[model samples]
Target: MLQSRLFMNLKGIGISFVPRYFFQINLSKIFNEILKYNTKELEEIQVRVRYYNKINQFFTPTEKEKIGKFPFKKTSYAFDAYEISKYFKDKFLWNKDFNDVKWTFKDPTICKSRPLENNKNNILLKLDKNRHFCFLKDDLIFENKKDIAVFRGAVYQTHRKEFFHSYFNKTFCNIGDTSKEASQYRKNFLSKKEQMGYKFIISLEGNDVASNLKWAMSSNSLVLAPKMTCETWFMEGALKPNYHFALIDNENLAQVIDHFRTYPKEAQEIIHNAHKYIKQFLDKKKEFHIGILVLAKYFYYSKQLDLNELGYEREILELIK
Candidate 1:
């Protein structure tokens, strides 16, 4: 995560520290006007918009008073939220917390949580995007890489510490902790490129979601992780076990690794499925549209926007059908 922060700060410096969110917020209105979704495109957006914001009740004008906007402290999180909320502009409500927001509001509220199954009010946007949304180019194919599984990250959770102890000394595992307070493992930082040399890359859940999961999937190596507990815009819930990733737990990690090592074809297929899942997120225009539409639904349900003012009436109609 330290690496990601430095990269973004350098990137911000390159662009004179202009908030990219501010530009996107302004351009969103124009794009919303000019962009026309065909039936299929609208349908896709409808599915995602509904998934993000499941508010079914229309708040009365009186009921809308309960809604509240939250001021986020982190600049990156605030900027990301503004990119969508600026459309509604102080109209919609959001969770006040950050880093795996766990609270649920009585009224519909936007949030950036792991999207637990029952947390319907937590309307997810791709917040802390620079840290979570990384994709890489892999020149090494699965067959050419070493047969070992590698993991390199901060040990924030007890499960992470257990994982480090479980396989750190194994011949087939190369794992380390990046946190400063960590003991002997503190010196074992592996670069992203270095981890690519192995056939499997471990992606354990940190504070919420696995930050490395995106780039790990993009690599030639297969992603090795347990079932995802939380998800962001990448929709970890939609991913299939043993298809998009090699699902493993503390008990089955080595067995799963050995199975993949013996059956390289299956590993390649899982990598293929991961790449397919990733392809949808690469379309910048569609992603922007989906973000706007998700917030539009938020405003409508909160009664901040009148029914007639939604602008996506045709799309909404088709969505209901």
Candidate 2:
């Protein structure tokens, strides 16, 4: 009992000494310890953030992520304890009684069934993640775009590969890698500066969901992607199709391009709205603040927490307010 109090006090003292990024990186580890060991009297349990790098790859027992390791970096997580707990129940926790505990929950290329299928138990908190960094430029204009659309990196699945290849590396389609039979497509990698300059950024479902959309929206360019049935922490349910991105219907790429090109003013409006939305809510500080609420909600549902036990008590209250 005395040792637990000491641990909590040590955590309290140390939290103030570190930068938020330090906490963001280590919160998962810290919280995992609490989740595993601290069930006695719940007080300010550290809510954590992480994601899987393995994606679809199976890990051996040793290679598998340790309990509580949510493996993303660069950006922090707004921990969705409710959704995360559901994951735990399905993949790890086996107690049928946990069904009464209740919970809920992204990505393409790495495919999975439609996201939010069990949203009845899922609780969404806020959006947060890390991606390519580029300086925001006020001078960037639609005309600065070098191509109609630009996509880099590899695509999995035979059909998806063929779709990019059929474009034949010209005009509307300039894929980066040549190995895929878009042999004519440019082989040179597009730098971040060049990607930001383009008028339309292409986001496709890879693995499970596209990670590019968040950062793409951060840039001045307009995002073009299909209506994503898969989801992430902040996308899908949170984002309206036309509001957050220009729709790219299946096999209707040409028509979509013509519409956006002919009516650029409309495209610009969507771009403006997207930029404003991502920038306003997704900044770093708020990212951690949102993470705390996710943890709060999980505890609210599964384990009652005394107000004094919370680490970010003020932030959690602000959610209900």
Candidate 3:
């Protein structure tokens, strides 16, 4: 229900972002306009509008990722990556890959040594899209929260996990096991809002820069995280050390905790700074803009697409570059 409503509201925003120079009236526009009117309420919508000689794929996230399709085992990481391919696409093109889509809201595959683009300044940072986007609850009690940290997820594969309660006393942290049943696991899960009941939260690197890092940034808790070898949409050029999340090590976690406990003001300040930065930086509005820009670049640089036809698309790509 929430998604249905947001999809409808977002179309107007999408339309306003498009300039009038892209199309002059024609039979296609007439039909497109009629189709738009007929399907007033829907799970999603797909429409293409042309202005002059230029064309834009409306409802399209990016042309790069949408270009190919392949199958894998049930437990494959591609299973999740495959679902993400639907981020933006015409419902009818569900079978297709997001072609010329050089990037996405979050790529499941990235590491620090190998950056996406050669130019650091020109690299486009995207926000990790929450498939279950919803309004976060606001009833959390910030003042009377737990002093210890909490972690609840798959053991996933990563080293330097001494911070996961192995090195810390259980009184100060709780890194639970992974094999609980769905309902029971959910029962133990610390929700985005409920996590406010903690003074400290450990942000360890999972298969990628842990998604929890972003939530931790928005929360009122101090994030104790090590330098991430795996990068994500928000990590590359966005986060800073000692500002967004504290730099911790596999050893001496007790000392790290003691230091923060001694200087509580500094810990609070770090949390406050990260909260402010992420709140402003990862706004949903900007996420939408970045998604579109990625598509524009894929079209502009892709040899697969006829480059001549995408001449006007270069304007948007230029700004992104």
Candidate 4:
């Protein structure tokens, strides 16, 4: 859970710094736009418009109305970075509340550091060998329990060769559409998969889509992580609905052996150091304990039982009192 004081402090810092960054970048664009429209004929037109009408009337009706309704609207969209920064100043950043902060996760395998374009075939081969994991391809067969399906980012025909080689399951993750089309696309895909006796899963990329994906999964099939790991700020107060699983790689044979060899010294020390830092900053005694209590209450009230009943609650409460 996030403490109010900590939230306020972080919000203040972000509000102060982020706008400055935005403004510096936007200012250059504004200057470029001004230069592009700096011709004599454009200057004459501007002068005539300014003289014939009030300075505000030079703007389109919609723009004028927006300016009138929200005085900062013009500055908010100002091209220059500095002006843009000024526009955002002191405005409560929209997502200050954790209730408004969305959570999501993404497929780490699909989001590997290597460029997919350069290694698509190799990736496909790897998927074929590791048949338990899902692979994104078109023309996926909806057969066997061991196979999980995924949608290819590009054309179906191009992915057919890989699809032919793999076992098929009904569950899949899609990546092609923007948010506007996502709901519809998901519906259609689920319907098709259902017809073929398969279930579907959705993996998303950002906070914007996380809540929607959660809702979809609660009603339909499973929902995978909607955002990448790096996007999440773990301090946020709210926990996403527990229907979604956090997918992590279970240790392989090599990892198991390495852990045993390293556990007594370096690995254990590193883990201890991480815990100490977390305790110092995030879990400092009673204050942190209170935050957890408050979060438990909120989850109980929200009917989010999974969070309320997660295994740590008892141990956390024991520490709190």
* TM-scores for candidates 1 onward, in order: 0.84, 0.58, 0.57, 0.21
Residue 139's lDDT in candidate 1:
98
Q: Residue-wise lDDT of candidate 2 within 1-321, one digit each (tens)?
A: 357445544544454344434444444444444344334312322222212111222212222222233322311221222223322212221111111111232111111112534432233333222221222553577756755777776655454566676654557755565245454444777765677777887877655456567677777778888766555544444577777888875477777777888888888889888877666444554444444444434343333333335463453333322
Ranking by lDDT: 1, 2, 3, 4
Q: Give the TM-score of candidate 2.
A: 0.58
- Lowest-lDDT window of 10 residues in candidate 2? 93-102
Runs in model 3 lying further than 4 Å from the true structure: 1-128, 131-143, 158-165, 180-189, 304-314
Best by lDDT: 1
Write candidate 1's Cα lDDT for 1-321 as tens digits. 778677755553454344444543553354444257776776777788777777777653333432224343575676666655555544444433455754565555556664467777667787888877889999999999989999888877888877777777788778877887836666467889999999999999887788899999999999999877787788888889898999988778889989998899999999999999899889877876777767666666655654355455554534422
| lDDT scores in order | 0.73, 0.48, 0.45, 0.26
Better of 1 and 4 by TM-score: 1
Span of ten consecutive residues with least summed lDDT in model 3? 44-53
Give the range of the ten consecutive residues with the poorest summed lDDT in model 1.
61-70
The positional error of residue 216 in candidate 4, measured at the CA in angstroms, is 2.3
Clashes of each: 0, 25, 17, 13
